[model samples]
Every structure is written in C-alpha cells, then in structure tokens.
Target: MNLKAWQSLVFQENQQLNCMIEDILINSSNMFIGDQPLRARKIYHDKQCEIGEARLMEDYFVDNSTYDDAIYRRRYQMRRSLFRCIVDVVIANNDYFQQRPDAIGSQSLSPLQKCTGVMRVLAYGTSIDAIDEYLRMSGYTTRDALMNLVDGVILCFGQAPQVSYIVNGRENNRAYYLTYYIYPSWTTFFKLITFPTKKIYKLFAQCQESCRKDVERAFGVLQDRFAFIRHPCPVWDKDNIGRIMIACIILHNMIVKNELDAYLHYYNPTEFLNNMPTNRQPESYTEDDGQPSTFSTEFELEI
Candidate 1:
C-alpha cells in the first residue's frame, strides 16, 4: 500500500480497537453494577371518596340510618356519637383530615372518610387496600390517613403528669387503691404465698388467682377490640409504630370511659362515686417533650 493510505488504514484500525475496548468496559460495568430496575408508574384511580363519605353517613352516622346502633358500634368499634366527636376533634386539630379541594376543584376525602378508613384498619387489622371497595379510597390515601389520625390523637390527648393522692374519707380506712400492677410488692399486685397454713390463706390464694384472671381477661378484651395491636405492624419506621400503639391506647381509654356504665361491678359504685372529692381543683398537666406534632414529610409521602 502507499505511505499515505497505510497511515490512514492504521489510524482507522486503532479507532476501531478503541471503540471495541470502550464497548467491553461498558458491558463489564453493566454486568457488575447493573442499570436501575424500572419502577412502575403510579396508576391514578378515580376513587369516588365523596360518595364514600355519603355512604358511610347513610350506613352509620345519620339519624334513622340504615344500620342500627348495635351494628354501628360493631363496625366502627365505638358509638356513632363518639366517632363523630373524634372526627370533629381530629379535623379541628389536623388539617389533613379535613375535606379540601384538589387542583381541579374536586373535593377530596372528608374527615369522616379519613377517620373511618383509619378506624377500619385499626379495628379489623386488614390490609390497607382492603377498604378500597367500600371507602372508595386508594391504599396510599388510607395509609396517609392512618398516620395523620394517630398523630392528631397523640397531639390532642397525650398527657404526662406528677401527682400525690390524699385520702379524705373514713370508708375502707381511707386507703388509696393502687391502680397500676407493674411492681410485685405493690398493693395492686397479687403475690402468691410460698406456703399456706390456714384455710383462709388458701381461700385468699384462690381469690387472688381468680382476680389475676380478670387482668388477663382485660388484656384479651383490648386485643380483641383492636386486632391490629396483636398483629405485626407493617410500618418500617419505629417511631410510626410507637405512635400507632399510643394512639390505639388513647382510643381504648376513650371507649372505656364512654361505655363505663356497661360494666356492672359488685363493688359499691355509689360509695366510690361519693368518695371522689368534689371540691378538689384540677392541676395543669405538664406536657412531655415529644417529636413534632406534624411529620417532616408531606402526607402524600407518608406511605
């Protein structure tokens, strides 16, 4: 070949070799590092959340509704009145639960729908998507509602305080009843005797054992009422899980207070009622330091 042609041919061969080397490096890097897997595009479902709110109202909330009080209580895990009260309180405290308009001026889920969605998740321990059919809500929206509802409850009802009790009346020797049974030596704890001598001691042991069962029974009822308490929490964040538990406990206490009359103990309720000091003033509660009431991330990203 001519000198000029030979020079061009060598340059072209070198360029081809460099391109092949570059292609090999890319292939090796891809084999080891790999390209990012494709993420599914979000599918927007036209969940008719307004219709869900109306249906929920018709089924449980309205006067002379489709379902009776018993059915409402069974489904909602609280009386209609109490549910409404909670809805009102949460809506006032957390704007996320309140009904708002979208970019197109379409109304989003109402407070009732959001609260009901969270309630159903807690009460039934069902998957987040399970209520999509009835509530006409997307799973992401329901999960967001759950987080917001719990945050609102913790902010509104959470309290930590220090107090000393004073016994005033002569009834029952003016002894203060111990309500917490965590410590074995505490009055509320039923410690078993190592050895029993007298018949009364044996009887006392039996009575103590029986009373202890009541405590177990109380725990069982709590778990039964809120099935999610017993199940493994799907939330990846530890803080979110703790918030959920605290919120459930607060709700349980509210239910107990609302339905106190339903339980009839043989102990003289009237005597205990009278023993409560009527003139005692209430102390201002010192709020404990906690995480910020609102999450750092937006509601849409909570799930």
Candidate 2:
C-alpha cells in the first residue's frame, strides 16, 4: 500500500495511536523549561497562571511578583512560580504515587519529574546522586525524596508485561507431525531417544537462541550509546539505581517493539519459507536387540 493509504488505515483502525502522539507533543512542550513559546504561554498569557498566583498569595505565602519593579522581573518570577505550579498540577493529575504518599512528602511526584529522572538515569547510566543533583537544580528538594520517588517508578515498571511472539503452529506443526509420526521408521524410532522429537523442536531452540542474541545486542547498544550504563552508577542509593534500570528496560522494549513490527510488516514470508530446507524423509531401517541399522550401504560405510 501507499504511504497515504497505510496512514489512513492506521488512523481508522487505531485512534489511540493518534491520540497518544498528540499527548506526547503537548506533554513534551509542557516539560520544556527553556524560553520557548510554550513556556512563555504558561507564564504570561495562561489563565491558570493568574489563578495560581492569586491562590499563592491567598494561602499566606508572599507573592514575590507583586513587589517586583519591572514587568520583566515580575514575569520571570511569575513564570518560575507558574512552572512549579504546573509541575505540581501534573503530579496531582497523574497520581503516580497514590499508594506511596511518603515519596513526595504528602504530595505526589509529577509524572514529568518521575519520568525525566527515570529516563536520565536509564539513558545516561548516571548515578543516583547525579540524578538527584540534576533534579535538585530543577527544584526538587532532597536526594532522599528523589530516591523514594524513583522507587515508586520502579514498582510501576515491574508490574508491566514482557513481550513475546505467539506461534500458532499451522504448517510448522504439520511438518513436525509428519516427521514424528508418518515418516518415522524402526531405525529412526530407536534413534528418537537421542534425537530431537521433530523439526519444530529445533525451531523452538533457534527462536530462544535468537531472543538471547537480541537481548545481548540491545545491551551492547545501550552501553555504546549511553556511556553511563557502561559502568555501575556512582550513586549510593540502591532504590534510585533500580529505578534507572527499570527505565532502561522500558526504553529497550520500545525499541524492540518498533523493530519487530517493522520486520513483520515488510518481511516476505515466501522468501523466509524458501530459505528453509525441505524436510528429509525418515530413513528405512531394521532393529536387532534394540540396535538401529539403516539399509543404505552409504550409512554403513559412514559408520
């Protein structure tokens, strides 16, 4: 199909993907702290900022913006406060730590904060102390609190599922059945005790071996691309380190899924089938005192 048709079909079949991409765009923009358009809108033009600042003053905290002499100075402080309030709102809405209230010190950690910290440690292989420092620079208060938040994130990831392929065993199963039942002769039957049950058994072994190799390749990529994971994270806190590992696993899964999906979509099944050799017929044989012997003189000569 053409690209347009493919996209149309995807949109028709999966609205969720479209919605998710939109959400990513919006959330990513909100997460940006630089002097970008989205950040500016959050500070000066957004109605939420006005209400948040009003509530800030009403709650008895000194409103720093009220005393600033210049509009720029006032806007800067207001933007900082607005950004902080937005972070708090994001955390409250997600409720990522509904069960772990202790992590955020009475409030929940924002999703952006949790995700960013997790990704940084996972992607960079940085130490928990380093993650703490990075987050602290962004306004997180304590290393202990960050570590607790990281632990909660890890718990969330542990609950996620591992990916695997489903083999329905159509032609593959038929071939196995033929080899094991219809084609087996007296000599082959005696050899069955030591040989594989069927070609499907070998396929299963090959699949598992391929999976192991894929995992090793993924780890190699991570180590090469992200230098920090090449060595142990220098952080002393185990919880923080665990969260980083979970985040890396999640990223790895995402990459694998994308690659696998592409392979499945574009790969030619005919070519794959052609690459596999035709199954050989079981050799005819005779058995004497439970010993197997083939009639072919070439087999006897080889022995």
Candidate 3:
C-alpha cells in the first residue's frame, strides 16, 4: 500500500478509539444520573433484644419469678397488675410498642422490654446508658423507647381522670371543683378576702387555707411516689420533661385507683389524708333550683 493509504487506515483506527471512549463515558454517566445516592451500610450490632425480654419476664413478670409482690411494688412504684394493664394500653395505642422483626428478619425488642426500659428510667430517674447491659438496647433505642412510652402513656391515660369528679354546687355546670388561688377571679376560682374584716370572710379564708393544704399534700404524695419528680430531670428537652411528668402523674392516678381497696383496708390517717382529695366544708348553700350554690357558708350574725 502507498503511504497515504497507510495514514488513512491509522486515522480510521483513531476515530474508532475516540468513539469507544465516548461510549464508555456516556454509559458511566447514565448509570449514575437517576440512581439513588450511595449511603454507608448501617452497622448491625447484635444487641440480643430477645434475651433482654426473657430476662425481664423472668425477673418480675413470670408467675414464680425472681421478685416477690412487695419487692415488685417497691421497685416499680406500682403493682404488677397495674403495670401489665399499662403495657397493654401502650401496645394498643402505639404500634411502636408492639414487637416486630427488623430488616434482617430478627425480632426486635418486645413490648414488655420497651415498657420495662421506660419504667426503669421513670421509676429510678437513671441514665439511658445505665440499662444497656441488662436491656441490651443502645442509647438511641432506649431514647426512642422513652419517647414512644411518653406518647403512649399520654395518649392512653392522660385524659381519663380529668372529669372524674363533677362539682355539684354550680348551676352552669362548668365551674371547676378545685381552682388555685393564683388564678384570676373567674367565678370558677374560689376567692378569699385579702383582709377579713367580717366573720364570714374569716371563715371562708380558713376553709380556703385548709383546702390549699390538701392540694399541697397531694402534690407531696406525688413526689414521694415517683423519685423521678423528686430529682432534677436529665432530659435536655423541656417538652419531653413536661411529657414525662404528665405520664408519671397519670401512672400515679392509676396506682391509686387500682389499690384503693387495699389502701382503705390498711388505712393510715396520714397516708389516707395525703392520698385522698380534701372534703368540702359544710359551708356551701343551695340555690332556688336546688343545686348547691357557691362554696361560701350562710352566716346568721347580728352586727
């Protein structure tokens, strides 16, 4: 072949090489254009959540378990039956508490384990990492469990005790049974005379002061029952702290209701007075409609 023919063949081969390179680049671009971005694979830690569940059951839940009833009550700050009822309510309210398998088909933590973890945190006010060895849950998992438990408790039991008592003295039926003195002078709030010049005013003040002590003592009982409230909360979030408090109060009410019979049977005046609501003084009157009127007493005094 002539030199021109040889050069032409080399030029054709160069064109073929350029086309191949372009095709390779185009294919690479197409592969990544619409694809999901690469993410680091999650490291799976064998936390053995099942073992945690079994250990919890054997420790307190089983019929012939490790701890006795008194020990269970002291540790959990409530009875076993009440605890189980709360667990059922939580599981029913939120699916997160329901035990389910993870992506790897291994069963995640059980409902009992999640609630037990939460109760441990609330009952003792312990750190999240403190439960790691026995629960086999990471800090993240335990925190998640706490949030879920708060939500569940609030959802299930938050509103039940609110309207439990209906104050019978009001015609409108909207008056609050027990209103704090700090609240505004709405008819709902029972007001006291700042300076009691009259006998009736002095009597009202006495009754109000007595009732206020009952309220304070009720609060004291709550603090005594749950150590969580007695200590400074470790949670950084203000909202979570409030939620945990509300949950603790609801649990307290449930315990009181469940153990009312037993408490009455073993009545101690100090304990009973601390736990129960204040009895209204015999100062209340009745309206023409026959429903009791305002809480102040009828005075027959000659001035």
Which model scores highest in TM-score? Answer: 3
Please give me the total number of clashing residue pairs in predicted model 1: 0
Estimate, for each residue in 176-271, the C-alpha lDDT of model 2 and write its tens digit: 111223454754231122334788877665565566578688778766644556786666667656665664565445444534644665545664
Residue-level lDDT tens digits of model 3 in 23-55: 887877655656757789999679888888889
Top candidate (lDDT): 3
Task: Report each candidate's C-alpha RMSD, comma-separated, in the order given.
Answer: 19.4, 29.3, 15.3
Q: Is candidate 2 or candidate 3 better by lDDT?
A: 3
| C-alpha TM-score for every candidate | 0.62, 0.33, 0.67
**What's the distance in Å from true for residue 43, model 3?**
5.4
lDDT of 3 at 187: 71
RMSD of 2: 29.3
Cα lDDT listed for each candidate:
0.79, 0.47, 0.80
Clashing residue pairs in candidate 2 are: 91-110
The C-alpha stretches of model 2 lying farther than 4 A from their native spots are 1-114, 126-149, 160-215, 222-227, 238-243, 258-266, 276-303
Q: CA shift at 1, candidate 2, in angstroms?
A: 99
Give residue 64's error in model 2 in angstroms: 31
